[model samples]
Target chain A: MMAKEISKSNYLQIDPWENLRSLSKARIALGNSGGSLPTREVLSFQEDHAFTKDAIYSDLKEKELLKHLQDFKLPVYQFQTKVSDRKEYLKRPDLGKKLAETSESENGDFDILFILTDGLAADAINERAIPLLKEILPKLNDYKIGLCLVKFGRVAIGDEIAEKLNAKFTAVFIGERPGLSSPKSMGIYTTYEPRSETTDERRNCISNIHENGMSIEKAADLLQYFIKESFRRKISGVKLKASLPNQIDRK
Target chain B: MAYKFTLRGKTYSFKDLKTVLAKATPERSGDALAGIAAEDNKERIAAQYCLSEIPLKAFLDDLLIPYEKDEVTRLIIDDHDTEAFKPISSLTVAEFRDYLLSYEVDGKTLKGLAPGLIPEMVAAVSKIMRNQDLISIASKIEVVTKFRNTIGLKGHFSVRLQPNNPSDDPKGIAASIIDGLMYGCGDAVIGINPATDNPQEVSKLLKQLDDFRQQYEIPTQNCILSHLTTTFEIIDKAPVDLIFQSIGGTEKTNSSFGIDLKLLQEAYEAGKELGRGTIGNQMMYFETGQGSSLSADAHHGVDQQTLEARAYAVARKFDPFLVNTVVGFIGPEYLYDGKQIIRAALEDHFCGKLLGLPMGCDVCYTNHAEADQDDMDSLLTLLGVAGCNYIMGVPGADDIMLNYQSTSFHDAMYLRKVLNKRPAPEFEEWLLKMGIFDDQGNRKELKEQMLKLK
Candidate 1:
């Protein structure tokens, strides 16, 4: 049977050359960091055995500022436009940045924060977020109340709230840009010792968590490591990236 | 005038597309486009009525693959299936460096076969395909896309309609899977295993398919890949094919004999009532399960009996575009396992011979999933001796490299020459070299066997 090929909004020409430059070298290269970091000390063995490999994903921070994150959990309140139109989701990312009034009042404070959003393919949230959530939440229970858990409908990152709350770290679980093969895949990113000021570059990510990619258990473990290392070194991004390992394995 | 309000959460908005299009097109007469428009409207309405929905663009993007390659008949195995297992990720430059050294693979070699990795899989799969191969091969990637269809301006694979809550939405799920397969597969016929148990859901599926066919350009999705992609459709009509999943089996919903007879009746009545009706034109498929049941003594397994009965019933039923294939139980694994390929082929062969209908073909076991590697290879050479015209199995299901430059078989040789340069030797060899190229595209001896069955 025949079907229609509906067009979605993508400003491919917005800065075609720059887009290519960004997608390639910039997206792949670690800024100042060469993947070097202090050894993370797990306070409890109870927190071990989390996240499998396939469940990893990452993204650029929404804002451009940076800060050292001492703590992270979530209350980076999630807010989204009331509109359900796909065009609006793409056009009004600002709506995705704010915290709903009710969500703000209900959300508790935290040294860390987590926000879950239905980025491009909301269908992937379970494959990507559920496990990370399951693993990270229990581990973080030892800390202050985690960021308020609220679901939003777009692609804004955690920095918007961190900038407002002056929190230490920001973590967000969202969908990866849909791929021909992996449309409904999910990802999670976190910045160590984050402030409301951290930009996309300050965090690391774990992606491709479908039955076809990394599983959730591994994604959680990766996030756990990112958080521990972030807290320990008081840094993330190019500072921690330049001299880390021999090979990358997001195969 | 009545204004239409559709359910938004679960639909792809094809309705909106149609509505807006209709408003713009302004049909010659309202009544003229009513039937076509009404049908499209129904599917759209169903999608919108849901509380959640899959994005229509996703499905359409996928559907484009099959539409583009409607003439190629080859089977595809995407390396991406294996690549999803890799262990690296990033956001910034520093993170990428860290990703490279994120963890130790515990001294695993990138060489030799082991488990799966995500990027390598996608890379490997992409490596196997050339730009030319796009329309010639029927691909089976690991992504969720299942089949081809239209959404708006173009055709694409349908998106999966996953509901956060599991309460219901079988049609959406079913439609999404069909779309996924259609999108992922090359211009080969696509099919998906239904996600729901509802009998009515199957009908909705058929209606959607018919609607898709009615709305968009659908080239024949058959080709070398049909030998195997054909199996996907057979399995999809399980009430019809599960009867063949095992030999001699029965399912509650699809009584092979019953469905066939119903179709035959419909064809007969339609033919008499009008100038045209699908007699053999509607559609029927060849189905055979894993070789274990190829040669049964007497429809014995409860599952076996049911399947055989269903198979027999379907064959004798409406008798549309028909084909029947039995496992080519000649491989080595069948020696260890039990694949009466010869016996089953002959039985099905004999059945076809007597009925004077579509021919019956025999196949060798291929999938490592079905048998061991060497065993599948051993069966390939013997297919000639089995007196079967068709062989069904993917290439490299047996051998690591798919260099079929030597074979005289159609699909096998075609793929061998066509897929000769594929970098991923194992999958290309298995899907193309061993299965489609040999079964549908070439093979004189097998052709003779088919004649015998016919």
Candidate 2:
């Protein structure tokens, strides 16, 4: 039998969906050159991935972040998890959830505590954390608030910090895992009466906060709503339903 | 029972069959994380040697998780084909490996022996064999299934056109579907992983997929990968061709996913009642991966690869049209790098095919994992050679919603061109009629007719 000859084309065949690229960030309408991605598109994808990788390895600007936290006129404290460095933090997630033996802790009675950590993407916390806090700090001014910055921390670290500080609620502002399109996205996890043993089900999360995704103002509003409802119902997470009056219940 | 072997003047003893299986597994990060891996290479080889001498009947005698405690174990024991086991029942694990690689064991013999072999037995043999051995044995075994078109025929390759959107936007999904169709993909299914599990949103996406499929007259099936209960709640009102679920090996892991054998059976019945197939009626699609049970804290001390094999037993019970292992989607903590991902994908395909299930692979990796496009290309090429049933066909190999990179439409075309494979026969014919491909099966330039799909 004779082998079939593979086709070769000199120019790329552009997809008509190129007009629809604005509708979604998905990599659609990629013009092809004989069943393969064009040279420019391939390189463009690689460049975006490079940015994401860099973000994952980037360090949090703790000094700058701490200065920004002081603008709220609340007490600011810094802590570190048990993880020694980034490599260990990525390999052993269990270590990142525990407090370091030497790290200082604060004993304060507060209604809400905000803890910031540079999760998979430090650029997220560095770029958007302050702007979001500015939008949210005033709405929560009627109650006592404390700000804490952690290095090499995971989501569960907030549980331990809240338990130590004796706060009624904990709102964690951590960087999300960087996606190709949205490298500077942060996630907020709010839990009521948080303890070190708290599982993921006990916390309510609002993710994908960035310039390209959810705006800081919208996230602040959602966080405020969750805090008020949690205090009223004495619950959070799976049980605390986000039942806004304007939205219809799909169920 | 205790198993021991003396290798290079050092004696190693495993506490039980589960311990031996875990020790003998290839080096992976999940086993190391679970603290079940051998301390060194010599200990691993000793465990492999000890495992090779154990007879095939030993697995049947000693249950890994115990029949009474785990429904998966009970299913395996109750569904044993004793008569079919007669041919290789007397062979030890080493002998079984040799028997499979022998010249006489062709596709027909393998199919006849499939029901007789358990997941543990196949996983054991796979542990001792090389990557090429897995490929060679799997290429001979053809486990075909059908919904609207046939899959897993000899000299045929298929692609699951995964048009996932971040927010389930209908127009964005439609554009991706048309793009995939223009490249002659989506023969296996046009499946989507919805961002939310709301039944209303799932029903809307299902309706959009069904309408687009009907409008284009594409020879394929459509599925929305959601929780089993969500599908059941909307099965009566939606246009679902295949019921999709992410199944695991143990009862507890399935519980975490909120599913059980009874729920799976119920969903199967619902899909069967719809009668939504033109050629055949195999209407279940399952996605499994290594370390799912471990992630759920329910592995029961078994290795990830062995548990992955047991998941195939669940898929086989329902006779699924398509079953794939999202091999690398479970992060680096499970499969550290490219080498580990490739090994796990080959092992999954080999084990699934040997157990009489139609196995495919997602050929994907997460951004956090230490892998790149080169790794995906290598796995895709190897799976194509191993007679994989289907691979994911995302545009440009980037999944924006899930934030992972998988095989691309161009990767599928490259595999077919290099391996001399064609799409499912019916779908290939549809492509010809639609002017997507010329008579020689070479892709044609984009035509005006193709762009007028809307």
Candidate 3:
């Protein structure tokens, strides 16, 4: 009698939803082998995780970023927070929120101060900050603007810098927490009359600014709208609800 | 009152009950960040020793947060079941740990004792116990709940198929739901953490999930994890099954989340009035983590773990169907690493189970944290052995929307296979009918099941 022949493909179970992968970037329709994920899918997931980790730990290329910021024709100031390094930054968020005692402050009368910081993901700031600034700076040309970049800083750090500068408003460009799919996403937080004690409810946030999410141009447009409305109403954050054309006159 | 303990000829003193609890907690980064962690291992041990001698009844008398100031504290004090606490009222914290681990205290006994114990008492006993002690005691207590299908029964495992999409796209959510169902997940519920909190957007996503769930006749409920106020606004208009909220331990923390006891009570009554469940009416679903109170600047000099247990006290009051600790989703600032995350997960599960809540874990980690997939595997296995009610089933262990890694559908399958656990009985019968699993409770080949779902 002939020996029985068995096929190795019998063990692999491919889901029909594989075709639906185009609808979203979510990791779905990964075929399985005996109820566990296939080797290729598992390795791909690990690879993405490794990349995300790299993006988080990577430094914000300060020299390159400074060169790009200079092109905006605005004076750039550099500072550091109380956080000494990456390790300390992750462990002590309070330290990241405070300005370092050694860092020099500049007192300026400005309408809006733009502050940039390397938050949880430095690569986000390294890549997207300049592009977003390019889109936003020209729109705010009528107002007096001050630009500054701080290392090892959190979003709230901008409040202290802006407060020292005597700026009427503060717009912060910081790196958001890196997701697996989007490592270079940036966020914009704009606060009116930013003081050291300003809370989160006192700011308006526009998040997920990246190639795949909200484009830089769109984020710039939204930031411009917020600045104009906030300056007009002398308010920001939760109280500054987006007003439609009809609702604008009522407010 | 100040408490002190002499250990190895060195004296460690804590100024108050909150200080003692904070120092007694295991070394996690959150406490250190708050500047309240024990100075050294010896100091931690000293605090634990001092805590062990305190009587269980002292927790009732000496409150952590003053009852007059915090509604959560007042709720705990008002809800104390002195009748039920009669069994273990006289035991010290150390003896309470031993009593819980004793073979004499089984599931039914734990159910009876749950009403008598407060979060602080459970949190204190947990500090003195080892990891195995946490797991072994938690394994004996089963907290069964129901909305459509019963959950937390012994030898039964469940997964809350997340199926989250970044933009809340209907097709993408549907695709993930199908994938999870083919892998024999979604026995708990199909919960979506929507990208937008806009009321219209939330309503659209909730309607989509409800439509798909009703279309397939799946024996499960669906929820949109939006803010509670958003849910309340749309609950009357949409097909709301389980109201979802992210509650914290302290009154201020809940305030930061834009909630209070009155708001929670309103949402609870709104969910109950919906009258959507067929099998049971446990309508509330809550998600919590260790460091929420601290993150909101509301920890009140208390440790994260103790505050986390207090959040469970809030959950138990509403009689939620499912309460999950999204353990490692809070970053390294709170948990630090895999070891801390694992310890927090075990402690949260143990405390919640003892408090008579059906506890699940989102065995997850952010990329920034000093953790990896291996840590998640260890936690998943340990929770499985501890008889955790459910774990999250994200697509391929990566939540693109939330930007974190959680337990996947395959991880749920792995847990069921290794532990010989099956899905909720009603869900398993549906799976059998759908040909996802055989009568022997083993998963079948998925090609046909995929086609059926497609």
Best by the DockQ measure: 3
Among the candidates, what TM-score does chain A have in each? 0.57, 0.90, 0.90
Question: What is candidate 1's lDDT per residue for A1-251, written digit by digit as tens?
Answer: 88967553221111112222221111111111111111221111111212111212222222210111113423334353354454444433444555554433332345666666666555576445555666666765555534433344433346655554555676777765443234456766667665533444455655555554555665566666666777778876423432222111222
TM accuracy, model 1: 0.26
Clashes of each: 151, 0, 0
Question: Can you write out model 2's per-residue Cα lDDT over A10-112, one digit (the tens) per residue?
Answer: 5667775577676666787787776678898989989988878777899999999999999888988898889998888777676778889886656798899
lDDT of 3 by residue, B58-103 (tens): 8999899998889999989999999999999999999998899888
Q: Which candidate has the highest TM-score of all?
A: 3
Error of 1 at A145 (Å): 4.1
Question: Which run of 10 residues does model 2 chain B get worst, by summed lDDT?
Answer: B445-454
**lDDT of model 1 at residue B286?**
43
TM-score of 3: 0.93
Predicted candidate 2 versus true structure: per-residue lDDT over B306-413, tens digit per residue: 999999988999989999999999888789899999999999999999998899999998778888989898999999999999999997888766667898888888
lDDT over C-alpha atoms for residue A94 of model 3: 90
Best by lDDT: 3
Report residue A166 deviation for candidate 2 (angstroms).
6.6
Candidate-wise lDDT, in order: 0.32, 0.86, 0.87
List-wise, what DockQ does each model earn?
Answer: 0.01, 0.30, 0.39
